[model samples]
Target: MQGHGYAQPVKQPPHIAWLVFLRVLFVVIGIFSIGFLTWAMMLRLAIVTRKSLDWGVFVAVLAANILSLVLLATEPGDEIHTAGGNLGITLLLGTLVAAIAYYLAADIRHFHRLHDAFTAHRSMAPAYGYPAAPSPYTATTVPSVPHTPPPMPHTPLSQPPIPAPPQRPAPARIDQVRAELDELSDYLRKQDGHHDGHHEGGR
Candidate 1:
């Protein structure tokens, strides 16, 4: 085991972006340990290592953020308003970053798969005399018949026709109406006369 001197180089310490990713990630674990551990003073508080303290600080930061938001939302005028607000922002961004990281990790696998598929397709095209790939959704088939039409025909939209307004009822006559009114008045007068005749009959 000692004969082989070719130990793998510590995968070139992560670049700036990677470091940022790590630090951003560091918060997830940092809140639990790194936050406090980063400070030299905390080393003497307990038997905690530098690494462990940072994690606590990071976690404590998250907790503090959560606490501040809760306090701010519940009691707006709380003395720790500034601290709570800052923590709230940190918590939100950190949580978002974490979620994005989760998605990135998940999608990386798909990206790798696509890469492999592309390579495989390219490798096979020369062997089969197949046409070059255009895109994933594009059709690769060549024309079979002399006059092959487009896959789908173009057509204008068939909008529902607006209905015509209904015909209005015929207008009533003014002279006839007046005559009917007169007839009604006469009928009312006869009813009154009948009532009077009844009174006379009773007498």
Candidate 2:
């Protein structure tokens, strides 16, 4: 599907002044050790730039600040009297500040690099808010001829007649069977009577 012929405006890179302001803010907050606020700002910058080194520096500074605070609170009486423990705590606080400054510098450099790349990309992209040119070749449709299928061979509807099955003989009636049995019994009785007459004559 074709989109509406209007081109969309290109998005410009973020202003360099904003990044500078963030760096200044990060440095100030790091000097004061403003709890998690410094950590939050540093983390935000790291996330925006997708720079792991920036985040690592922030974490180191945060740890140093916390350690310094702990040392200040837990110093023993003798340790407080001695200059060595006090000097160590001071160094820790200084290290934290230095780490913060380093991270801010790295972040500013990253922003500049990002802005340069983005500007280059935008320059290379096609101009926005303009309609695309029409293609040189125009599409012409050829009229399609309606196709007719070839006629099939005609088959005769009449089939060969099937042969009829052979007929079975009919069964005998019950009255015929009973008449045959009666005839057989009459013959047996005549034979027995003849034998009895012969026996009486002999006696």
Root-mean-square deviation of every model? 32.3, 19.4
Top model number, TM-score: 2
What TM-score against the true fold does each predicted structure earn? 0.23, 0.47
Local distance difference test values of all predictions, in order:
0.51, 0.66
Across 1-203, the per-residue lDDT of candidate 2 in tens digits comes to: 99767544435557778767867776777667534244655676667767677678668756765676666667677456545558547756667556666666667677677677767656654565444444758544767689999899999899899999986554565567777888888888888898999999999
- Off-target runs (Cα >4 Å) in candidate 1 are 1-75, 78-94, 129-203
Q: Which ten-residue region of model 2 has the weakest summed lDDT?
A: 125-134
* Backbone steric clashes in candidate 1, count: 20
Off by over 4 Å in 2: 1-11, 34-41, 76-84, 127-203
Clashes of 2: 0
